[model samples]
Target: MNPTHDWSTTPVTTNLVRGAADLEQTPHGVLPHRLPAWARAQNTDGQLAMVESQPSGVRLAFRTGATTVELDVLPTKRDYVGAPPRPDGVYELLVDGRPARRATATGGNTLTIDMLAGTAETTPGPADTLRFEGLPDRVKDIEIWLPHNETTELGALRTDAPVEPVPGPGRKVWLHHGSSISHGSDAAGPTTTWPALAASRGGVDLVNLGLGGSALLDPFTARTMRDTPADLISVKLGINIVNSDLMRLRAFTPAVHGFLDTIREGHPTAPLLVVSSILCPIHEDTPGPCAPDFSEVSSGRILFRAMGDPAERAAGKLTLNVIREELARIVIQRAARDPHLFYLDGRELYGEADFAKLPLPDQLHPDAAAHHRIGERFAELAFGPGGPLAP
Candidate 1:
């Protein structure tokens, strides 16, 4: 605490959080989760656990007259073995739907992960404080969107003025799940992620489960969606599966069915849009287990290449093309029985033509501009009138 500063301390409660489907109170503090405790317990995979707790779409929304606000957070920052040190996760502050400030929290614990070696080490550090000042000092809606990639434990919140939770606009909640592309990888900022942008344009609240490197058709993830409250839901499948080479078509088809079955258990009638993978030229027609191309790493670049044999497609090895075809078939078959179910070809969002204009820098994840394009396209296709998620 700064003795020179004067502000009233207010404990941030779950009531102030929006976009997180679940919250767990830990000894350190309250941790918001896109996945519930039960779902988290089901998977021992450290990768899935890390990303699910990153608060991808979580934000604190409230109305305040305060000119100054500070939030204390204990962040779990990640470091890779050979890659450049990642920037401290970004916190975006919006005042009355306009970007007011952007900040990064320092002094947090670091987790070193060696993906190739399959190892991780955690080192304890101090909590970081994010401060926002120079507001208009008038009652207005303020939203502080959390970092999309850091696992944050919420701590004390301080404001010079009293705070109240912002009332919802009574819009439907849109729950979405996908791979790193959907997780805002290489995107400009947290709230500017494609899903967040789409949610904003659609006038709906978003709960994003875009787990980077871990969207492996996990049953627990489907069950999490099954339990979460959502008026509209979408699952973006295929890319992660292809990259990991997790399963072939024989297994992939049933996995998709089982995942949808689990979700339908809770949201049978909700507009469940099944979205296929967007174009990744490296794996569009080629099969993968995608491999890191470290040749550019020394030059401060991170790139990926498909490692699987293209000829293996005949053996039913999964590729983006195969998965797209399978997903469309499944959705078409299911739609015959489930009227609310719909299918969206991800290519429609980011396809051959768009790629020509805005290429994926990493040959996998889209850059910030591509995210904007995808978000805008998705908003029109899925959230526009007469669209699957249309009100």
Candidate 2:
């Protein structure tokens, strides 16, 4: 036993005291400690919104029941129309790894906790935190069906002693921003978000501001980024801008500059990475609204100004290819003065090679496996030692 370590069974408000205390926490307790699953634009201001759980892997609050355990779930924010066919309410439940009573919730503004003496029913209006009272205390792990995202702290229950903090190196926030890909699109669980997976793999905390369908280099977004706290940061840009078809080369260049300038305002010296868009065959040089064609499964093409179509081929619109080229140039230009700045093509995370093999089930969002692959690659590339994660 190392002397510096606290090996005592006695009470300590701080972390455990063990020998040779060279290690504080293992990389287990990744940061952005709590997870905030979704953000929504109610009217204009994007506010944090919560929703019902998915069909599986819900992050739930657990307590021992004499014969049953209680469960609580939060809904997804910005529940887009493209979401999986699962209903927007509680549909099922399980206890002590055994099937229990099931229930459902009617559509309402608020979601909540419920009581299931023996059966689980999906009713409505219990709102935030399910208390599973009167269950046999033999249940060890309680699992629920939901996409558990946006958690900060995890606490232990039914004990006199305080719940120990999850072990990990102290919080090292990984600030990331991107499109639907980053928003856990079609991903299995909350922890499957690329940012979340990478954070866990790299042993860092995370601050994920990945918005679905909202990465269009908007002035407001840049301003929001500028104001946010980012110790280690990366921005995945381009695809959305291309698909949005909102600007021309004249405006695009200035827009990119403005966005970077804004982010720099807050994190002047942090390790900042600028990413170009990933390969989307249709959207590479094509422009967008990238809407659903509803005509064909593979009709996910970029919408752009066309010679024949009065809407397209307008001013100086640049495609993802154009942006990727310019982003390199911009980094090359500004990074001369800002040595900390770096660039990574989005394809580095998910390139044409991967795309060909794992075409997205939806034209926009990658499937579960793709999300994990991207996360693993990111963890290795950005957070690995001597990598971009180094302070």
Candidate 3:
């Protein structure tokens, strides 16, 4: 918008994107996807499609000497049908790998989701520009982390100076998959997501496939992870499975095996860590087809409750506790043949004491503070000197 500075338009290309699995060429610009086209095409679930396109750990990385940078983006923000208006998605600018400034775009599309009705509607709107100014006028590696939860369509990237794609950091590439909590949930910003934070502390590049309500051990997802190149891989299981009541214990055990087997096909020597869900009291022991507590709707706060009967575990219904036990057993059984495979109890990241201190705001997802806690814990447990992912 400043006429004094000569602005140069740069194309948003895959080389400039750090964390997305695919780049979708849209009319406006390139849209980053956490899942590749082939994998995305295999699933018809609206939630999966929407979340994979949210770009939780995705960022635009380039080297530039510009004091001012502007990006045009059309962000699709989510709106619960009856709850309070969700906050606008945040775009964080990082200079030389450190947080510099943050801004939020206005007047983009809105996706209204009615969980009760199991329906969603999108209302189109106009694109908005995010401008970052007053940077140090020397060449530096710059990264603009996209909103972790919003589905964003990127447009022209303008800078006062010419920009070129930055090379990778020469660190290990960590590919991770999980539920919405891993997808970012209520994290403060894109880079602050637990996985992102862990990757940062772990000194690794991240490819986050944390689909909201969609980490259902789908074969396509397994194949995606199998084919993607990564030095370290982790999958956080249980929460989404229990909440959706997608499968019983009988189905889940084999599904976990098949999923890991598929990944092993491509990454036989990569360090693979299987993580269970963090402590969620509601579904800790109770089997779920979790339902929203409409009683709190009038109070402008939405909470969830497990609806499945506790007695149903005897009938092979899956619960978080059951899933954790099964995952531990499976890892032990498989570790005999696969020495690189490891199991991490999700509770190690956020367990009973931590829950008492920093509880899950939604009874399912960790809040921003909890995200930081989980990230720090993960970095220590998995990336520490003697840890499983240590070099």
Q: Candidate 3 — which residues are off by over 4 angstroms?
A: 1-6
Q: Any residue pairs clashing in model 1, and if so which?
A: none
What is the full ranking by TM-score, best candidate first?
3, 1, 2
Q: Which digits, one per residue and each the tens of the lDDT, describe model 2 over residues 127-201?
A: 344343433345243333333332211111222111243243246766777776776666765566677688778
Candidate 2 runs further than 4 Å off:
1-84, 87-169, 296-314
lDDT of 1: 0.89
Q: Could you estimate the TM-score for every candidate?
A: 0.95, 0.64, 0.98
Q: What is the C-alpha lDDT of each candidate?
A: 0.89, 0.54, 0.92
Candidate 3 per-residue lDDT, tens place, 1-391, comes to: 3455578999898888888889899878888998889888888898899999998999999998899999999999899888999889999999999999999999988898998899999999999999999898889999999999998999999999889888765788999999999999999899999999999999999999999998899999999999998999999999999999999888999999999999999999999999999999999999989988877878788998999999999999989999999999999999999999999999999999999999877788899999999999999999999888874
Residue pairs clashing in model 3 are none
**How many angstroms is residue 288 displaced in model 3 relative to the true structure, after the best TM-score fit?**
0.9
The alpha-carbon deviation from the true structure for residue 54 of candidate 2, after best TM-score superposition, in angstroms, is 12
Task: Assess candidate 3 and give its TM-score to the true structure.
Answer: 0.98
Give the root-mean-square deviation of each candidate in angstroms: 2.2, 11.3, 1.4
lDDT of 3 at 250: 84
Error of 3 at 269 (Å): 0.2
